[model samples]
Structures are given as structure tokens and as C-alpha cells.
Target chain A: MMIPTPSALAYVPFVSVANMMRLVHSLGPEHFLSELAAYIEEDFRRWPDFDKTPRIASHSRDGVIELMPTADAESYGFKYVNGHPKNTRTGHQTVTAFGVLSSVATGYPLLLSEMTLLTALRTAATSALVGRYLAPEGARVMALIGNGAQCEFQALAFRALCGIGTLRLYDIDPGATAKAARNLRAQGFDVTECRDAIQAVEGAQIITTCTADKQYATILTDNMVGAGVHINAIGGDCPGKTELHRDILLRADIFVEYPEQTRIEGEIQQLDPDHPVTELWQVMRGTVEGRRNARQITLFDSVGFATEDFSALRYVADQVRGTDFHEPLDLMADPDDPRDLFGMLMRARDA
Target chain B: MMIPTPSALAYVPFVSVANMMRLVHSLGPEHFLSELAAYIEEDFRRWPDFDKTPRIASHSRDGVIELMPTADAESYGFKYVNGHPKNTRTGHQTVTAFGVLSSVATGYPLLLSEMTLLTALRTAATSALVGRYLAPEGARVMALIGNGAQCEFQALAFRALCGIGTLRLYDIDPGATAKAARNLRAQGFDVTECRDAIQAVEGAQIITTCTADKQYATILTDNMVGAGVHINAIGGDCPGKTELHRDILLRADIFVEYPEQTRIEGEIQQLDPDHPVTELWQVMRGTVEGRRNARQITLFDSVGFATEDFSALRYVADQVRGTDFHEPLDLMADPDDPRDLFGMLMRARDA
Candidate 1:
């Protein structure tokens, strides 16, 4: 008898880094971010249905590796990510990641994708999605204080979702600011390269601090954050890594994704344990108010959560279902007879 | 400007199902299992060097998906596995798995491998390695009560590791028994097809029960177990799933992998919480005794641990170092300038 070929169940759709970039470019960055933000917003509205998980982290001397997992009734997703502060010195990304999406019923993986670019996309999408709920009405210009890898994505997502037309960029390195200005200008945005963070936020309604220093540095002090401006603190994601000053957190109406985790990693880590903050999902669901008045300080302690990654995975799985954007990988072993795995191995030698 | 391709750091070595089988056949399964058992035993001897992890699991009505992660000082590894009892009804295996091995210093993945076959290999290797210390000296016969996918591998591993020369097999389904017997006989073993579980264990020096029923099962009664025989009970690995009668456990000197996990999943779950059990690592390290006399019952209540999977990944990574048994996978996004990820994306548009 001839040997049997592997069944279709053995293959999983894998989106490589190249394929992910292709998928993103196929749908323009602005369009992709808008659709992705909508997906995240939909998940946030029904956030009570998700199994919110505490990321399992393995800390080392130089960096940390973490597995963040979440599940809904139909699907389960998890991301494997690492943060090595010194990786930049070696010409490697400070954060790199990959993720898997699986079926909750069968426990079989549906898609395995390069999550590095997807993570950047989803983080930008989430920021814009939250901005829709919390940013000042008619928010036009935004100030970006970190013109690094994520600068352009954030600019694009804000423009797509919140109607931000102009960007003021500032960074410690003039080269980073130039890169952001050059890229944003090429993408048809009115970009201004500012020498200081103060000048960057001069006439902007939204101020985003996304510096990459691993230590606690006051990139945005209390005085720099003006009233009625939405503050998106993206860099203060790990313990002892805050970008905003303590006074900013105390003065602003802080909103967070999964307070249990944000209390440990977000800018709110500088506050007392009992300090009150609004859950972002409740605000998105409309049970709690967001941006009560135009002059109120609204700060989003943007510690990325697993549910956002879940939504990103869901979006990618939907967008690449029948397209030529993915390859079938033999990640699983399927036997001709479920109970005869050894028999199958024996037959492999014959073929 | 020319766009740069992903650097070497962006690619991880991936061993697919075909590659894993090819690797296994390159170094024959018996030899592979023996070497793998040595790797496992080496890890067991210095168990304190490992950062043991509690597996994270997501449970649904019909199935459960789990991520088991562990790290040593030098390397980290994790396996994603799922158990769905009803999957066999739809031509899927009850269990399937894959894993990633990473470098601890950089937090970068070193290898991604299909682990279903590796899991089967490692599980049998662990049992046979434990058999070397616990089973009676010069034992030549093993009675396997569950003759499904795992039975032949158990026989092969035991023979290669401990010099077992004969086999007696039985399963609830006679078809399964026939399959195992045929597979084992082809590989040069004295095989016997038994009428029932009672007939299978008669006069055997090693009794291995590996049924796949997801509920409580009495595959071996109190009287059916003879003294001086080492009982390897593997199927009763989850809560509410056990094979041996309570009386049999009470009479035997039990051994376990990790106390905290085994207390919840192993056969000893039926016993008192404070019941005494020997840690297998301690025995392997010579801190505790394994089997003292020929007349005493030695039961290895095996609940698979994360360290064993870590060891398997380590072994495969080492074995396939220079071989074509793996492929380079574009799993991470690598920008030429680590901080200029957006610039890299923009340049990719022309490429």
C-alpha cells in the first residue's frame, strides 16, 4: 500500500514578516489602522465576554520574555514577546513578537503570524480607538514626543481615526525626528520637527509620550501636560519605566485597560494602590463617562493588554482567510488513524 | 534606496512535522529515545537549575489548551499543547503540540518545532528512564494495558534503555491491540495479545497502564498488581482521571515528577493531601531511595512536567544543528536600524 499524505488538518496558515507587510500595504496603512481600530473597539465594547489573563512573564537579568494569552467563546489567542533593553545596541529590535490564533472548540491553531509589525499596528490602532472615546471633540493636531519606530504608525492611526491633520515631532536624537518628519511628509501629513517637547505641544490638542528609555524619566512633567489635552503615555509599560511625571497621573482622570495589570506596569504605578481610575472598557460601553468636559485632563495609561492582541489576531485571521497572503505550514501531526500514531510512523519508512 | 531584507536575527529555525520525522529516522527512534532520556535525566539530576513553571491552561467544555513554559539560566522553552477527547471522533488526534526554544540572554527564539512526535518520544523516554531505576533488575517482559499510539513507543524505549525483550499488550478495543502488536512485532519483540487487562499483567516485571479514557478508570485492581513489579501509570494525568485502584496506591511506594502539579493531576490525587510521595528528581539525585527490595512495589505516577519538554527541545536543537531537518522561518521583523522600523516599512513599498 502507498503511504498516506498529511491531511489538511495538519497544516496551519502562517503569515510571515514579508506577508504581513504585504497584507498591510494591500490595505493602506491608514485604511488598515481604521479597520483594525474598529475591530478593537468592537472587542472593547463586549470586553466582559473575554477571559482576561495575567501575562506569564519570565524575567532575566537583561530582559523579560512574556506569554500573553486570552480567549473568547469561539477563539483563543496568545502572543510570545520579549523586551530586551540592550537589544538596540546590537542592531536588533528592543521588542519582538509572534502570535498564534486557535479554535476554542478543537484546540487547533488556525493561524500563526509574525506579530512584530502586527503589534505595532495594533498598538497604534488601540491608541486611536481609545482616542475616539476620550480625546477632545474635533481634535486636529497631535504632538508626538518620541519619533522612533512607532512614531509614523501612531501618526497614521490618529489621522485615520481621529481626523488629526498635522503632527509636531520631537526626540532626543535629531536623526529620529528627521526620520519621522521625512516619513510623515511622504505620507502626505503636515509634519513639523520641533527642537523641544514644549514646542511640539504648543498648539496641539493631543500629546503622546512614547520614549523608549527603560528607566523612569520624566518625558512629560506635570507643567508640560496642559488641561483638556489627552495624554497618551505609551512608554511607561513596565515597572520602574514611567514616562509621565507623578503629578500628571494625580491631576488627570486616568483610564486603563485591565487595572489589575496597569497598576503594576502603567504610569499609574506611581500612584497609591487605592487611587481611583476608570476602566476604559466601561467607558467604551457607555456605563461610565469619558472626557466629561473640554477642560478636563484625560490621561490614558496605555499599558497594552492581551485582549488587544486577541482582536489583532482576529482581524488578521479574517483578512487573510482566502487570500494569497499566507502559507500553509505543517505545524501539527495528524495520523491516518487517530489511535495509530506509531503505525503511521512505521509506514513513513516505507514511503 | 534599496530595501534591506530581514537580517539573520529575524529568522528562527523551524522543524515541521516532516522534518521532525526525518530527524527522528536519521537517528533511529530507539536511539533517539535513549539520547532524549539521557538529556531528560541530566536535567533531572540538577533540577534546581531550572525555573519550573506552572502550565497555563484555557479550559472549554469539550477540550483544553495549555502553554507550558520553563527556563534555565541559559535557555528558555515553552510548548503549546491541547487535549480534546472528542477530537478522535472527527479524525483528529486527541492531543497535538508544538514548542519554541529561546535564548535567555537575548530573549530571542532559537528554534520552533512540531512537538507532537517529540512529545510522544519524550513521554516514553521519561517512563523508561524511570524504569531503569525503579523496575526490577534484568527485567525482560513488560505488560502494556493500553495498546494505543503510545504502547509501541513504550516497548521500544524500554527495550533500548533497559533491555526489555518481550511485550504483552491489551486494550478495550481489540483493533488497537492488534495494531500495537503488529507494530511492535515488526521491530523484533516477542509479542502477546492478551484477552484482558488481567491477562496482560500476569508474570510481567513491568506494568505500564496508558489508557486514554478521560474519566476515572480501574484498569488495574488491587489484587491484579503483583509485588516487585514497577507500575508506570501515565493515562491518569489529569484531575478525575485515574487508572489504578486506591488500595493499590496505598500499598505502593509512589514517585512523582513535581509534587505541586502531581498532587492535583496524578493518581495520588485520590489520597490525602499530606500523603508522602518521593520526588523523582531527588531519587535520581541520590537524595532519596528509588526501590530498595525486590518484593516492594514501586509505582511511578507520572505527570509530565515542563522541564522534560525543555530537555526535548534542547535535544532537538542540538541534534539538528547542521542538518536540513529544519528551515529558516521569517518569524520576526528586523529593521536595519533598530529604531527606524517605520523607515524600513516605507522602503519595502518599492521592493
Candidate 2:
């Protein structure tokens, strides 16, 4: 039996790590982050129409593997990601990811992309987008307490979306701080390598803590967080991993991507189950006000929701069209007749 | 500052559709199914050691997309699959899948493979493995109902595992039955293309029903099922999709992969929520008997489980070692300094 060749539907567009870097460079990271933030902002504006769920996590002693899945009525997306702090000692990344976007009608993948860098871009874009709404008007100096893999991206995103031109960087490891300072300075920012967290937050309108320890870390204590400053907490993402002291959370008016998820994995996990929090989508939709007063102390408790990843994947799928940035992978089994998969395999022996 | 080439750790082995077909041809289908069944049976024997959850599904108007995730202490695995029956009308497979297996300690993906063929192989192997315990002794004739893409694989597996040399096929669409008959006959089975379900099960000792309709379907009723016959119900996998009539399920001493999942998606979904069903693992462990008497009807309500996909990926990982059946994918970002991701991206401009 001679089976016909597989069709175009068998191919899926795959963006590799190398291709992702090239694409990011082709568009410029600043422009890429800005466009990605636009996509995220657009998705958040229609948040009520989405299918949302807390990420499914498989926790191990050394790390955690999580599947974050979400969909609109038309398209579905899911990301496979892992977080392991000890990986850095072994010359591996603390976090890595890949994601898939598919057609909801036919259930076929349209794009698969390396999401390690994309995750960083989305998190930064999300943080900077939140900064635009909650930070004091015309605020330019921002304190970044965790100068790790995510620091420079956040710096660029803040510069692009929120017009922040000055950055203060700090890390428990001096090497991490020095690296971030060097990268930010080269990117045309007034960068300072701070001595500590207190110095990092000094004279800054925004205090962003992104430390990556898998523990309840006091990266920022109550006294260190000044009044009227917008706090972006990015590192306390998983369970038992909180960045700020509980007192700071009690003082600030918090906004979250998804309340149900932010409560478990975000810094809000430190608070009571029924603690009041605002949804950023509502604020974006203009149904609720942001930064009610200059000294309101707005906090964006960013846990990195699945919809952000969904929006990121959607942005990449759109950008990679008619570009050499993606390789088409023969991932699906397409038979001449849909019921002749076995015959197709048999014929492939000779093809 | 040119970035160094990515480390070997950044590459993951990817088994594509063409390469999977080549691999299956190299090891012959029968041998592949037998080995896959063995791996599944081995994993089933140690059922208590692994984590389990019902597959998480995203249902849309047209079809459904699902993520099935599970892990043991050493490895984690998940499969992304979609079911869209209407896809076949447009020259697309009704079901397609891909899966990943990762290291639990590092949360790094070890293998990414096309599971469309593997899922077919695994599902057929699982049914035949169950058939070994449930099918009547020394039975050589089997009735096959709803002859679709899964029909031939089930026939081959039953012949390999249960010594069933005769095949009786019937389908609502005659073209499907003709295709299955031609394929099975070429594989050296004594084949009969029956006019209807009644004629198909006339003299067979085992009845395998696999239809891909997305609604409640009665391929067989209580009157159609004879005494001492083994019933392998395969198509009633999702909610609202079933094959055997409720009366047949009521009479059969049912065996299930996971009771929680089987109650929701398997043929048992039509029965009481708390209906007693035997765990297949217990039967494999010799803790529970499969078939007690010669005249009792035994039913294997297989909805397919995450552990089965986990075992299939594990088997492929072991088999593909030192082989050319897979390609390396640059899917992860591995920088020299784990915290210097931005530096790596900057250096990539000159690489």
C-alpha cells in the first residue's frame, strides 16, 4: 500500500533558543519588550473572557516543574517550565521554559517557542506595565534588589514602558550586582552598584525586589520601604518563597494578575486567605482607579500568571511570521486517510 | 565579546514524526508493542510510588485539549494531546500528541518526542496487556468494532500478547473496516470483514470496541455481549463519549486504570460514581484476581492514564540511547554565568 505524503498541517513552527536571541536582537530588546507589553496589556483588558487556572505544579526536593495552561475562545496555550535554585551552582539556569500555542477549533499547535528568555521578557514587561500605572508620576529612578538573570530585562522594560532612566542594583552576591550594573550602564542608563538593599531603595520612587532564593527571604523589610513608592515583588513566586516582610504587604494597596493564584504563589501568600487585593485587569479596564494618591503605597504583587505567558507566546507567533527565525518541525502524524495511520507508517519504510 | 557556543546541556533529544516512523520500522511493530506493554506493566506494578491526577482538560465548542502530567521520584512526564473528530474530514488526524520527560532533580527536559504514534502504540499495548488477564483461555478469535486508526494496532497487540490469530472487523463506515481488514491481513492475521457488530462478535471470545465519536455511543449492548467474553472498551475516553451500553457495564466485572479518572471519562462514567471496579495494578501485583470463573464477563474500562504515557516516554528514552532516531534541539538557555543571561544575549550578536 502506497500512502500519500504528509500535508502542511503536520508541520509546527519551532523557535529555538538561538533563533529567539536572533529575533530579540533583530527587533531590539527594548522594542520587543514594548510590543510584548502591549500584547499583555491587551489580554489583561479582556481578562474576564479567559479560561484561568492556577498552574499545575509537581514539586520535588530540588525544584519544581509547572504546567501553566490557559485559553481564550479562539486559541489555547500552555508553558512547561522549571525552577531550581541549586542549578546555578552546576552551571545550569535557575529557570528554563518552553511553550506551545494551538488552535482551539482544530486542536493543532501553531507555534512552539523557547520561553526562558520570553518568560524574562514577559515578567519584565508585566512589571514595567504595572509600574506605569502605580508609580509616582514622572518617577525615573528605580531600585532593583535582585540583580540576577531577570534584572537587566526588567531594567530595559522599565526604560521602554515606564521611561525610567536611572537604576540602583543590589544582589546578595556582589558578582551578580556588578554584572547588572555593567549591562545597564552599557544600555545607556545611569546605573549604581549599591552596597545593600537599604541603599538600593534610597531615593527611588520604585522598589523592585526580584531575589531568587527558594525561601522566605526578607529582601525588603518594613522600614526600608518608604511611603509613596511602588513596590514590584517578582521573586517570591512559589510556595514558601516570600520577598518582603509581612508588614510591608499590610501597608500597601496590592494589585494582582489573578487573585486565586497570587494568593498561593505570590508574596500575598504571607497574608490571610481573605485579604483584600485589587485585580490589575480591573485597573487596566478603568473600572477601578490606580494610585489613588501620591502616597498611597501601591504594590504590584507579581506572581507571573499563565495569561502573561499566553500573551507572550501569541506575540512571538505573530512576530515569527514570514521570517527565518523559526524552523518547521514534523511533529504531527498526518495520514493519507485519517484512519490509515498504520498504513502510512508501513509505507514510510520505503518512502 | 563573543558568546561561547551553548553547552551540551542546552540540547534536548527530539524524536520527530519521520524519525519515529523509522524507529518503529527498525524494531517491527509487534516487538515495539510487546516492549511498550512490558514497560507499562512494570510501571503499573509499582503504582503506589508515583504521583497521580486526572488529566487536566480545556474543553472548547469543537473539541478538547488536555495536559496529562505525572511524576515519580526520579522523572517527570507529561503529554499534550487534542481530540477533534471533525479534523479528519479536513484531512487532519482526529487525535495528535507530543510529550516530554524530564529529570525531577534538575527539572530539565530529557526527551521531547512525537507521541501520536507512541500514544497509539501505548494505548493498544495497554488494552492487550489487560487482555492477557481478562480474555478467555486459548481464545484465538477476536471481534473488532469501530475500525478506525486504532483498529490495526489493537489487532496486532492482541495477537502478540494474547495469541489471538483471527480478526473479525466491523465499522459504521465500511471504508474503515475494509482498511483495517487489508492492513491486518497483510500483517498475517486471519481476517473477516463482517457486515455488522452482531456478525463481528458471532464466534469471537474477545471484543475490542474503539470508536472515535464524541458522544454516548452504543457499539454493543448487554444482549450483544456473550458469557465469558473479555470486553476492551477503548473509545469512550472523554466525558460524554462512551461505547458499550450501560447494561453491559452493569454485568461485567470492570477493571480500571485509575478509578477517579475512569469514573469521569471511561465507559464507567455511565454507571454510578461509586461503582466497585478493580484496579489493574492490584491484579498485576497478584493482590486481586482478574478473572475468577469461566463464565464471568470481564471489562477493562481504559481511559488511558499519565503513568502509561510516562512509561512509554521512559521506554523511548532508553531505546534511543546511542541511536540516530532523535535530533538535538537547542531548547534551553545555558549561559556560562547563570546570572549573566543578558550578557549572553549581548554576546550572541557577535557569535
Candidate 3:
């Protein structure tokens, strides 16, 4: 049988960094986060349908590169990401990412997208989605420690998803705190710049830490976190990198995206291997309890997972359906006769 | 410290299928094959330096999609490939591939290229390279039992690398044999088209079987393969797919790329679990002998490996150094302040 020659079918829709930013702006940040949260929650509620595996990582002296793959019955997705904390010193992003979505039936890629911006949006959405379930009632204030790339996204996602109206920001670098405070003030949020993590947590109902370090520095001490507070920990996402003290994990009701991954790369990595932690999917599925009482501390030990990236990909693929925000990438080779690949190359010579 | 904004450095060089074919033609097929053979040999001699892993595959009812990743001290490479045996019936390729080469230190992709043509080239280069050592001295004639997409390339590679002057082509379909014969005839090789497998191996010092089927079908039987003939078996690449009869395997001294991989997906799968087989790398390194006698039957059980793909990517990255065969793909996000990713997004509003 003769196969069809090259056409648009051979091209995958690719969302570049410029297009991603344009799409995010076109959708508006708050609305985009809310919609992303909805997609994430829907996928989490059906988490059992996914083909899940811990990320395959290639580590180096300065950083780590990872491939996170997941698939369901209909579609497959994977993310290529890197974490190089020292990259910031060289004027490079500490974290950069891209992803692909493919059709499981035909083994063809459907979408390729820049996930650096999407990852920030989705991580914030996931925190906000889980916060709606675990955060205390009438939670209107958040403590955002380590004011870096992910700080402002967290503040806005919490505002859009959980009705959070104020942000208490802190960073080891005062310049970073000032930058975050300035950005949030423009977004119409009541912003507080704190001198230390202790001051950032004072009188705040939710605390989010997202520092950029490949070490085990405790951003939060056991004494800093009070009862009835929810901790959204995002920075401690690789081995030997953690933000919370082990004693803090003991006093909190821990929630994670995937326990197998969190045990190796999340804040819980500092704890015992068999430490009891509830999966956020179980909490979303209503099969397990999230927050026990008003006096209990809740922790969402957020090490990223493949499914969330898959959700973000699916979201972008869905949103860009009728838009020109994507370019077709001529990535796959299509020959007229599938078995006549040589003939195809020969014909190209004549052309 | 403030980082530089996005620029061409964030763009990866992407070579499309058409560009790849143009490259092959510009370099001349025979010379390109010889150069590829050299690169493959150089990488094989230092096989211990590579970080190797068996491909990760996701299988569906009709096919399988796979990711093969490998890295050395300086560069990392991976190929995204698919195998759908039934795709030819519906006007699609049974195998299509694309690959990326990245900087290990920076975690930045250096090149992205269509690997369909490259895979065909690399596979043929590997077989010819191995045949130079395993085939009997002064072997000029080769029996190409499956005259399909890969047949012409194999014939030319053998001509370039092993000085083979003649090709005897055969396939179940007469049209496929005609296509390969026509292609090879234009390349100035003395070509003979045969009716069946038995007639194909007549008076040939080398036998190459590369049929496209996903079953345990015997394309080569014991009596058809005589003594002193080196067989290059290519198409048996998955768990249940094999080409040669079990009896022929018993008589031939087998050489494989990787034992752990070949044991699961090569012609040697028919043998006992502990049956002895020499690694081709060892043979290339001169630690193990190949074709000890003129009367010995040597077989190269070829199930493509990750390092070979890495070599191909490295070769392409090297060849496209100062050429315009590739377009710069804006794939990475570079923010002015590495920690001010949200600010970057916010500034996009003014632009």
C-alpha cells in the first residue's frame, strides 16, 4: 500500500515560549489558573487510570535532567526538564521545561509545548486546588517564602482559586522580596514584605516556600509553623534538597501528588521511607481525610508529577484548538510508500 | 544578578526531513556512509564511556512507542521512535523517528532532527562495519533477502565499507524487489533480482535479512544458510519478532550489540538463556576474535542500540556545524531575572 506524501499530518502543533506567554496573557492569568486547577482536579480524581512511573533522571555535578512520562488509554505525555540551581549565577533559568503530548492509538505526537511558563502556572494551580480541600475555612492570607520565579504565580493562584486576598512575602535576598511585593501590588493584592521566614508566617493562614537551592536548607523551622496553617512546599523537589524540618513533617498531615516520587524528592525525603503521607488524589477522590481538625497543620509536599504536566499539556492543546498561538513543527517523515523510504529520498533529489 | 533576555541562544537548530535528505545528497550517499561508519566505529571503541539503558517503551495493541536515551560526559542524546507494523496498510510508515542532542552541562538542547533517514543510514552503517570484520575476506557479493526501504542503503553501505560490488535482491513481493533493484542499479551496483529466499542466497558470501514483520517468522532456514556465510539480520527488533530459524542459530557464531537487550529482542532470543554470544564492541575492541576461520558461519544479530543513535546524533550535530540545513527553533525560555519569571510574563503584556 502506498502511503500519502508529506502534509500537515506530518507536522505537530508546537507552542513556543512566545506563544505560551501570549496565550497566558490572552486567557488572563487568574482565569487560566482556575481553568488549569479544574483540569488538574479532574485528572486527580481519576488518577488510577494513568500509567505512572517515577521520573527517570540523569544527574550531573551541578544539576539534574529528567524525563517524566505518563499515559492513559487514549493519550500519552512526557516532560523534559532540568534543575540547575547554579544556572541563575550564569544568567540562566534555575528550572526550564518543555513537554509533548501524543496519541496512544497511532503513536504520533499531537502537541509540543514550552512548559517553563506552564509548569509555574500548573504548580500554582495544584497548590490552590489542594488548598481548597485542606486549607482552613476563610483562609484569606498566605505566607510566600523564597520570593523567586514561582512566588507571584502562587500568590495569584491562591487568590483566584482559594479567595486569598493578602500575601506575606520573604526571601534571603531582600531584592527578591521587593520584586515579588512590587509585582503582587500591581495585581491588586495586599502585599507584606517580611525580613525573615518567621515574620512571613506570622498571622498567615497558608505558607508557600519555593527557594532555588540544591541543598537541604530548612526554610521553615518547627517553631515557625503554627496550628491550622497549610504549607505549600514547592522548591525542595530533588534529592538532597528540602525546605521543611523533619520535626515539622511529624506534626503535619502530609499530602503528596505521588508518594513514590515524594519519598525520594520532596520535603518528606528527610523523613523515614515508610512515613505516613496521604496522596492528594485520595483526598480529591474523597476516599481519605485531608485535614483532621482546625488545630492540625496541613502540608502539601509538592514534588511535581508527570500527570500534572500531562494535564497542563492537555490544557494547552485544548485552549489552542482554534487559535494561531501554535506553529506546526515538521518533525515526522512521511513517505509515499511506507516501505519505499529509499525511493522517497531518491525522489527528493529530483525535486 | 539580572540575566540576559531571550535571544538566539534559546533557539535549538532543527533539521527537518527534507533538510536531512538534502544533507545526505549534498554529502553524497557513499561518502556519508563511510563517514558515518567512522563515527560509529569511534564510539563503539569507547563504549564504556556512555551511560546506557535499554529503551523505555509504551506498547499498544497495534504498535509500540519508545524513547531511547544515552549520555556521555559532554553531550546527551535521545530518540523518539515508533513501530507500527500495520501502518503500511493505512498509508503510514511502520517506523518513524526524531532525535535531540543536548549539552549535558547546561541542560540545553543543541539540535533536533528527523531521524527516519538517519536511522536507516546508521543501521546500514553498523551492519557494514560489523561485516567488515565478520564477513570472509574478499567477500564481494551480498544476498539482500528483503528488498524494501532499507535494502538500497544496505547495498550501498556494504559497497562503501566492505567493497561489496554485487547485490542479489529478493522479496516476497516482486514489486519491492524491483524497486530495490532499480535503486541499486542507478547507484552502479551489479544487481540481480531473485524469485525466492532459496535462490537469493545462491553464490553469495554475505546474506542480509531485513523483512518487515512483527512475528516469529523464519525468513532464513538452516539449509538455505551455508557455511562461511555471514548473515546480517535486522528486522527482528522486539520481544516476539525474529527472522531466522532456530536451527540456523545453532550453527552460526552470533555477535550482538548488547547482550541484555539482544537476549530479549534479537535472533538470539530463540537460543537458550545462557547460550554464548560475543559482544560486537568486544570484537571491535580486538579483545575477542571475529570470523576465526574461512569455514565458520558468523551471524550479526542486529537489534539497534541507544549508543548507535547517540553516535548518529553526534554525527549530525557535527556535520551541521556551519551549514544552513537547519532552522533555529525558539524552544527555551530565557527571562531577564531568572527569579522573575512572572515579571517576564507580565512584561509580555506591554510588548
Model 1 agreement with the true structure over B82-179: per-residue lDDT tens digits? 88878888988888999999988888899999998888999999999999999998799899999877788899999999999899999999998998
Candidate 1 residue runs with Cα over 4 Å from true position: none
Instruction: Evaluate all candidate structures by whole-model CA lDDT and list the values in order.
Output: 0.90, 0.93, 0.89
Clashing pairs in 3: none
Candidate 3 has a DockQ of 0.68
lDDT for each residue of candidate 3 in A81-163, tens digit (9 for 90 to 100):
88888888877787888888988877778998988889999999999999999999889999999998899999999999999
Cα lDDT tens digits, model 3, B228-253, are 99999998888889999999999999
Q: Which of the two candidates, 1 or 3, achieves a greater lDDT against the reference?
A: 1
Off by over 4 Å in 2: A1-5
TM-score of chain A by itself in each prediction? 0.98, 0.98, 0.97
lDDT of 2 by residue, B137-221 (tens): 9889999998989999999899889999999999999999989999899889999999999999998999999999999999998
* Native contacts matched by each model: 0.80, 0.85, 0.70
Residue-wise lDDT of candidate 2 within A275-295, one digit each (tens)? Answer: 999999999999999899887
**Clashing residue pairs in candidate 1 (N, C-alpha, C atoms within 3 angstroms):** none
Note the residue pairs that clash in candidate 2: none
Candidates by TM-score, descending order: 2, 1, 3
The complex in candidate 2 yields a DockQ of 0.86
